[model samples]
Each structure stands twice: as structure tokens, then as C-alpha cells.
Target: MAQSEHLTIPVGTVGSVDSVGAVDSVAARMRALDAALPARDGVAVFNRVYLAVTEEVGRRLDAGGFADPCAAAALDVRFAERYLAAVAAAAGEGRPPACWRPLFQLRRHPGIRPLQFALAGINAHIGHDLALAVVDTCRTLGCPPAELEDEFDRVGDLLVSLEERIREELMPGPDVLQIADPLTHLLGSWSLERARDATWTAARALWALRSCDDVAEEFTDRLDAAVGFAGRMLLIPLPD
Candidate 1:
């Protein structure tokens, strides 16, 4: 087993506004937009969508609770960390190595640099850490960790070359996904659909990671927050 550290679980809450609309409503719409997604594709896209969701919701809650309650803020932080850890672990463990195609495709977008520098740093590091985790897991499982290890090395190399690659853009542009789909539409710099899908899947996968009897209760126990970073969410006013 890998050397372990104690994990702290922060307390967070979903205010009435967050539980109903900010979270439920947005999540529903985002799912609608992603109706056509393949399950496998969902996994690949999870981290991107998740970071976006946490950043977006976190912003809303932060604004609403800027001076409200510490418990709520703690809850949001815990939720964010749990989701990220799950996403990172997923990217770390798998049969064949997962493709980075989606990630690379996103990189070509016009806003990549700024998005990376700002709200999406978690994605980059989680991505980097997860890629390495996959290698480590593969080694433990007695699988050939060569390809994954190489992939990890490639990303590690790129991470040193730039800032955005060092972190991820919180979800793709709203144009990148439409969680609301045909039922409704989503448009903005960030896609609400991608964010929702990512959060759901990451949480689900993270929750499912334990293989032993104690796995369910013990999983994510090793999770921790990324250090020294700032994240944001925006509420834009569109001009008619």
C-alpha cells in the first residue's frame, strides 16, 4: 500500500437555493444536453465537467454565503475536494490506459491559457496526479504499467512547459456542452452540462472505487485539498 496521510473532511451544506436550482435544476439541464453521451465518454469528460461545476456552484454559494455560515463554506470545500479526488483516482486506475484525446482537443480552444491560469488549476494537477496514480495502480495490480507510466511522463513534461496544462480550465466553454440539451439551452464561457455530468460521474466513480469489504467506508479517506490556489465562478449578464 502507498504511504498514507490523515484526511480531513470539511462540513458543507447546500442552501435551499443551491439544492434546488443551482444544483438540481442545473444538473437536470446539463444532463439533457448530454443525453447522447456514451458512458465511456462520460468518464473521459468527467473531470473537466466536474471542475467547472464545483467552480460554478462554489462561486454561487460563496457569493450567497460570503458572510453567511462557515459550515456551508466548509461543505462546499469538502464537496469540491471529494469530487476532485474521485476524478483523479479514476484517471489513475483503469484496464487499458484512458485516452488524453479529449484533453488535447480542449487545449486547442482559444481560451485555454486564461482558463488554465484561473479557475481550472485543480483539473491540471488532478490530471497530472491521476495520470501518475493510474501508473502506480497498474503496477500494484500486476498489469503492464509501461504505457500509462509513459503517458504520465508525457503530461508531466508538458506541465513544466506551461501554466494551463499545469491546471485545467473549469469545464469547457458553455459552448463545449449543453447539459440542458434540447429541453433547454446553455450558453456562456462555461458549459453547465459538462459541469454537472462531470460532478455526477466523478462522485459516482469515486464512491465505487473500493474493492474490499471496508472499501466503501474507507475509500476517499486519503483525499486532500490541493494547496495554495484560488478558484472562481461567474454570473454573466448577456446583452440583448
Candidate 2:
């Protein structure tokens, strides 16, 4: 595990008017994280992928691509904080969420491919963090999940596109990949589209269960474990 490195930006409420600054602050922190880690570190690999996505999202926000800039910024920042918090926790004595533990634990292993690290991080973030981020955004914006649907869908679209690009850029080319390769099968098994769909459902369910604290907590814990299990599968070491 890496030593604790404090992230300077404080996570706080972002009102509608401060959306741009909030997004910029989040992007800045991710840039700092990217600079701090060794390039081959699994966490660093994932961070680079995420940093690209964050930069693109920031560009979209500046270009007015989202219908609700305030809602989009809130969702984007809250979504990012979950991943950052996990990194921070793992850096210190505290443990990250179950969903994120596998990647952090195996980040430096020789056998795991960069693509595996990238997807595993995506699995942890999308499968687990996204739902909670939705709830967090709702609480901050004082609106129901339904109201945030457009922003959610838009952000998800960006991730789905990025997933495709990640596979292309990191995975062995089609000419090089063999049918018997475990990486091929593993890649075939998980789909970001499926994960995003499931996340939306989970977010809605969580919102519905918000009034029931114990039940919601149990649901979240179960979700965390399930996603972590999937992440572990995604990070399975493959032969060179």
C-alpha cells in the first residue's frame, strides 16, 4: 500500500452557480493524483483512464452538453469523490470499501494486465460508487432521482464510450487475441452497458429505501460485496 497522501481539496456542497469551479477543482485533484503515482502502478493506470474521462466530461460541461449543468456537476463531483475517498482511505490506516479493495490490493502485481486494472477500477466505480453518488446528488440538490435521469444517462453514455475506447487501446488487438485466451472470455463476460443499467436500478431502489435506514445500509453493504466480487474476477491475473 502507498503511504497516505492528503488531497488538499475539501469535498463540499456545490451550488448551481459554482458548477464550473467544482468540476475544475475535482479535475485538478485527479491531475495531482496522476502526477503522484508511478505510471505502471495499477491505481495509476486506472487514474489515468479516469482522468481522461473527467477532462472530457469537464469539456462537455463547458460546452453546455448537459441539460442541467448544476445537476451534472453535482453528480460528476459526487461520483468522483467516492473513488478519491477510497484512494485516500487506502493510503492511510483506514480501509477502502469492499468494492475497491481488490484493485488497491493487487495494483502492483506483475501478472495482471493494465486493461484488467482499468476495467476492475471501472467495475468498482460504476457498479458500486455510481449508485451512491446518485443518492448523494439527490440529497444535495434536493431533487428525486427521476429529475436527474438525463444527467445520469448522459454521463453513463460517456462512460460506455470510454469503455469501448479502453478495450481498443489496452486489450490485445483482434489479430493477436486467441479464442482460448482467458482474457478474451473475461472481457466478453462483463459489459459496461449492463453495469450502467443495473446502477440506475440500484440508485432508484436506494432512493426508495432511503427512509428505511437499516434496510438501505444492508442493501448498500450487499451491493458493495457483490461489486467487489465482480471486481476480483475482473482483476484475475493472465499469462503474458
Top candidate, metric lDDT: 2
Q: CA lDDT, every prediction? A: 0.34, 0.89
What residue runs in model 1 are displaced by over 4 Å at the alpha carbon?
A: 1-147, 164-240
Model 1, 1-240: lDDT tens digits are 211111211212333233323343334433432343332233324434544544454454545733332333333343343343433343344221122222322322333333332323334334323423343334333344343333333332333333333233333456743565321221234432333334333334443453543663333332212111112121111121
Which tens-of-lDDT digit does each residue in 190-237 have in candidate 2?
Answer: 999999999999999999999999999999999999999999999999
- Cα lDDT of candidate 2 equals 0.89
Candidate 1 lands at a TM-score of 0.24
Please list the Cα RMSD from the true structure of every candidate, rounded to 1 decimal place. Answer: 18.9, 1.8
Off by over 4 Å in 2: 1-17
- What's the CA RMSD of model 2 in angstroms? 1.8
- Model 1 superposed RMSD (Cα): 18.9
